[model samples]
Target: MYEQISHSLLNDILNRIKPDIYQKDLRHFYTRLGANFYAIHGLFAKLYGNREDFDLQAQRLVETMARQYIKREDELKQLDIERERDYNWFLNQKWVGMALYANGFADDLKDMQSHLSYFQELGVNMVHIMPIMECPEGQSDGGYAVSNFREIDNRVGSLEDLRSLSEEMRSRDMLLAMDVVLNHTSDEHEWAEKARTGDSTYLEYYYTFESRNIPDMFEQSMLEVFPETAPGNFTWDEKIQRWVMTVFNNYQWDLNYNNPAVFIEMLDVILYWANQGADILRLDAVAFLWKKLGSTCQNEHEAHLILQLLKDCCQVTAPGVLFIAEAIVAPSEVTKYFGEDAVIAKECEIAYNATFMALLWDAVATKNANLLNQGIKSLPNKLERATWLNYVRCHDDIGLGFDDKDIIQSGYEPQSHRRFLIDYLTGRFENSFARGLPFAENIKTGDSRISGSLASLVGLQYAIETGDVDAQENSVKLILLLHSMILSFGGIPLLYYGDEIGTLNDDTYLDDPDKMDDNRWVHRPNIDWGKAEKRHTPCTVEYDIFNGLKKMITIRKEINVFSDFNNRELVDVGNPNLFVFNRFNPQKFHDRVLVVTNFNDQPQKLDLEDVASWGTYKQGQLFDLHTRQKPEIFNNTLVIPSFSFYWLREM
Candidate 1:
């Protein structure tokens, strides 16, 4: 990798390194830098070489890494060495995560530490504290509109509070994940303020233009992210007297990665948080990183290059830290977030499994696994080193992001199926159990998303409201069914904050003027400690879901096959209501686990001979790993109960 020109330039850059950085013990830093600098130099050159100051930018990037390495604490530095030796440590199945707001989960960062026992009780080891960074005073896109990248929001806690929380979580072997708004920032940010005052250097930080001539062209292919609220991609900034590309909303201006300085500055921001003890940084809105004309300005090739460069730089500084690409695109394009590598993820170590998530919802609406099986079979295989962040719900709307061709192949027209799902989930369809709400509904395009908490969307809320015991039990089974899928579907299962106790949608958002327009806030609930205490009671809904998921998580961690390493195989069981997949222990061939889920309200039967025909379970007595009991079989057929799944293995 040490080409003559690049390494010669790197030698000069290393020689120019500050004496303070050189005086420190940079043995591991230098070794990693030397190994990664060639790729770093190439990516930086590819991004900024035509500029006259490319060499200067290269020098700046190196020094940035050196300075950050010096700032990295001694304990974190030692942890980096340990992780580099155990490079695939993140892919372990023992890692279970939950996404929550610090204020929602507890009171703030200081209070979050006191509630660590709550997560431990639920078998969660990684806690993704959603977007606590400083944001604007009013309606801050639920904390997504980050105003200060390096400071925690005053409402949440002080920086010292967060550091203390991270330290405590590390002591307990728990991972701390925080958000970094990579694509855009609040209009009130310091950089945006400078741009408004007509500072050319700061203006270059964003995609601002004097006229709409270029923006109109860009608009021809760009799609509206928030079609109801923000109808266009570019917004007219009165203060700057210019149009800036605001992909998400008018108040959130997109950063221009075309500027190499922006890249280095963001890298510095990233390492700053890494030094704050964030184990994983979720890169928000990563799909919209690189914008281009005559295209959707998403999933561009240069975007991959930008991620690769960022990851390389991150490796040089904090090798232990990981990245979760929040690119909620289609299955065909989503895997690219992991980079174009067979065995290495040069872009990101993890990505959101949007397709899998959307498909699971479709199965919930239709009570069949035909589309779920078809959609998963069509999902492209991810890289060996990269894995997925599988979840039933999060702090967002459900987009039904499955491919149209998969719908057609599953015997349904694409648009009609989508409408049917929306109607059914929203309770507009006949006898629907869900109480979902509509979001971003568009009349012109007939496109919309559904928003509700997991409980509401799956009938727990409606069942409890109507006081139906059978229906309520069914809802509990469905809730556990969904969690079981994510827990065993070959990746880290990220349970949303309130889902552990079947927390229903919070309609109180309708009273808040700032949040009323956004129905997604209905699902971002405030954790109810009073109701959460019900989990300790045996006959409560909270008890069933919390205990069920805790058992599934414990079983998942005990099984080596659940560690994602390209070892899963989708099994076609010849029954439309059943979804079957096999997970094989990479270390032992005989230790295979067969997972079967039934998505019907009535019992479904799949013949044992057909499943064993593949020689997978031919030689063993089947036992449910979660239940520790043999599966019920009759006449050579296995019976899978309604709204239930089994992690079965040979006893």
Candidate 2:
């Protein structure tokens, strides 16, 4: 940590530290900076070594970390020490999270603070309030396009209000997660505005070119992220008389990480949020951080280096804060966001389990686990210190990003199977109960994603519309079954805001001109307090789902075996209708729970002898953790009811 060359550079930087930073206690800062400066120096060099101002940039990076450390609250510093002592604190089973839009969930930050009791009632200890940063009204990209890095949107209340909400959450023993859009900024942002006015310094902040030659070359390999809407990766800036890389949309200008100034500025933004009491910061659009001409411009090595540098810098400033990688790439590439380290995560501590989420949807539509079983088997194992943020639904559309090999092994053509899923969820297929809409449909590849609330996509909307009691019951069972998988599937289970009360897809966005173009808004509904009240009324759809999920959350927190320690073992039970796995405390093999789910419309039986290798399934009295009832076992075969799951443990 204190290598000669690195420490010599550190000593020089420390002596030249600005008066404001040197005025602070800085003992802790010096120790941490010394420990991490070697890696930081190496990464910063790799990213900007060729620049004339490389040494100046390194000095600025160290100064930025010192400034943030000076601003970090005393209480937060104590929390950092505590978290360092228990490095695996976040991997515990007690941290269940819910992702929601601040304005949609309640009125704003203050109103959301008033409803903290609602979160506690549902047993949710962590809450990820989606992007609420300042942005242009109509061009906000659902709040991802930021106009200001330090201010909260006026619609979502002031920064003081957000601080109050975070403080309240912390007092109640809850964690607050916020989003930091790392990749780009709204065209109306001050930086972009300056570039528009021919400020040479600001012009270098973004990817701008005078001619179309380089843009054309890059377009040859760059895939259009919004082909239906934006069409290409480069947008011609009329005022600037040049082209700028706008990978997401025309109004969202991508930042040039090639500029060390950009990296330093973004690091300041991350630390500012951490000081505001964010326990977790969701890094948005991380995979597209760096771009090259000859490649697809995603998951590039430089992007990883940027993230590693960011993590190391944050560790010195706010070690209590964790990062959730928002990269929803291929199954193989998704784990890379957790970093290449075999036992520890050098980048992000958590990532979205997009493949597993898609696989669960496949089982729901097919009424079988053939693809779900195979796809999960293909998912690479993540690092021990890193975990997954597993969920059934989020603000985004459901993408079937399954590996082609797994699809072939499951006896389906990859292209046709993907088409089938789009058709099935969009209600274009026969006997389909789903009421989802197709989002981002690509005419060239016939590829698209599904958009709708969990309740609507899983048949609750249609069942309620037709007033079919049997269909309604089946939908409720399907909802609980999907949740059971995420809750016990070796990660932190994230519940989408409206899923607990069976909130249906909202068509209100259809009337708004700004929102009509994006069907993802269909699932991002405003909570109806009148309907949410039904959650307390017995036998209602809301009551069934809310209470059912509450029980699972309670059970999950009590089960130490559910903690993610790479202890999950996928069991091949030789039954296609049943998806089975085992969860056990790695230290105590005898303490285990066998999770079994029947993805069929009819009862499925699993022979206990087939899973005898799991030990507890061989010869013991077992009970369902949810129902607390003895499972029906006849002739050494266990029967799983249709559209249901069991978390079985020896009684």
Q: Which ten residues in a row have the lowest lDDT in candidate 2?
A: 612-621
The number of clashing residue pairs in each candidate reads: 0, 0
Pairs clashing in candidate 2? Answer: none
lDDT of each: 0.92, 0.93
Error of 1 at 181 (Å): 0.7
In model 2, the runs with Cα more than 4 Å from the true position are: 615-620
Residue 123 lDDT in model 2?
95
lDDT of 1 by residue, 1-651 (tens): 447778999999888887888898888888999899889988988889899998889999999998998999999998998999999999999999999999988989999999999999989999999999999998789998989999999999999999999999999999999999999999999999999999999999999988999999999999999989989999999988899999998899999999999999999999999999999999999889999999999999998999999999999999999999999999999999999888899999999998999999999989999999999999999899999999999998999888889999999999999999999889889989899998999988788899999999999888989999988999899999989899888888999999999999899999999899999999998899999999999999999999998899999999989999988989888898999999996678778889999999999987877775334333237889988888887766788999998888877
Per-candidate RMSD vs. true structure?
A: 1.4, 1.2
For model 2, state the Cα shift of residue 61 in Å.
0.6
Q: Largest lDDT belongs to which candidate?
A: 2
